[model samples]
Structure formats: C-alpha cells, structure tokens
Target: MFDEFRAKRVLSRCVDLRKEIYNLPSDLNKLRKTDPKKYNDIKIKLRDIV
Candidate 1:
C-alpha cells in the first residue's frame, strides 16, 4: 500500500516535470532572441530542473 502511494506520487511529479520541460523550449527561444543572457540563465536552470 505504501509502495503504491509512493509510485503514484512519483508518477505525478514526472508528469508535471514533463509539462514544464515541454513548455520551456518555446519560452527559451523567445528569450534567446530577445535577451541572450536571460535565455542562457533560464536554459541552465531548466536543464538542472529536468
């Protein structure tokens, strides 16, 4: 029972992380074009998060 609960929690976290990464690229591109410095910062943080 505990294992099942832990598995569900991990799976939910994974899904949320996937969504964040999926949305990040477009935003990263926009930042890259408009502000290279901020873009790099975001890219690095996103990499660490993923």
Candidate 2:
C-alpha cells in the first residue's frame, strides 16, 4: 500500500513536470525573430555552457 501510494505520487509529479515543460513560454523563437544578434549571442553562450 505504501509503495503503491509512493509510486502514484512520483507519477503525478512526473506528469506535472511534463505539463510544465510543454506549457512553457516560447520566448526564444520570438527573440530570434525580433533581435537575431542577441539571440545568436545567447545561443553561443548556451552552446559554450551547455
């Protein structure tokens, strides 16, 4: 019973995280369109760090 409850809690948390990931705001695409230079800079920095 405890294991079933823990599994359900973990599954629920995963579902919540997936929903948050899918519903995230798409500002990067907008930035790419509006200010490409800044976007490229960000991309380059992310490339180096990530």
Candidate 3:
C-alpha cells in the first residue's frame, strides 16, 4: 500500500516535470529571437528537468 502511494506520487511528479519541460522549447525559441541569454538559461533548465 505504501509502495503504491509512493509510485503514484512519483508518477504525478514526472508528469508535471514533463509539462514544465515541454514549454521550455517554445519559450527558448521565442527568446532566441529577442534574448539569447534568456534562451540559454531556459535551455539549461530544460536539460536539468529532462
């Protein structure tokens, strides 16, 4: 029972992390045109998330 609860928690965290990472590329692309520094920062964050 404890294992099942832990598994669900881990899975939810993974899904949330995926969604967060998914937004990074689009944001990075937009920033690339206007702010290269911000784009690089986001890329680094995205890499850490993945």
Candidate 4:
C-alpha cells in the first residue's frame, strides 16, 4: 500500500516537472534582465531537479 502511494506521488511530480519544463521561457537571458527574481527561482528549481 505504501509503495503504491509512493508511485502515484512520483508520477504526479513527474507531470508537474514536465509542465514546468514545457512552460519555461526560451529567453532566459531576457528573463534574467527583466525579472531577476523569477530567473533565480527558475535556476534554483532546475538545480534541485538536476
């Protein structure tokens, strides 16, 4: 039962990661200049993912 729950949780997170990756801006340089906060946030997220 615990394993099944863990599998579902992991699957949900995978979908979330896919959505975040898909929606990320193509121009990160522009983002870094325009919105440093969001750019840094994205960097932190990517760091954790990788």
RMSD of each: 4.4, 8.5, 4.2, 2.6
| TM-score to native of every candidate shown | 0.48, 0.46, 0.47, 0.68
Give per-residue CA lDDT, model 1, range 1-50, as digits (tens).
56998888878877877886676666656778989987787667657656
Regions of candidate 3 where Cα sits further than 4 Å from its true position: 26-50
lDDT of 4 at 26: 95
Clashes in each model (backbone N, CA, C under 3 Å)?
Answer: 0, 0, 0, 0
lDDT of 2 by residue, 1-50 (tens): 56998888878766766675466447989978888997787666546433
Model 3 compared with the native: what TM-score? 0.47
RMSD of 2: 8.5
The 10 consecutive residues of candidate 4 with the worst lDDT sum are 41-50
What's model 2's overall lDDT?
Answer: 0.69
What TM-score would candidate 1 get against the native?
A: 0.48
Position 2, candidate 2: lDDT: 65
Candidate 2 Cα errors over 4 Å, as ranges: 1-26
What is the Å distance of residue 40 in model 2 from its true position?
0.2
What C-alpha lDDT values do all the predictions have? 0.73, 0.69, 0.74, 0.87
What TM-score does candidate 2 reach?
0.46
Residue 39 miss distance in model 3 (angstroms)? 9.0
- Find the 10 residues in a row with the least total lDDT in model 3: 20-29
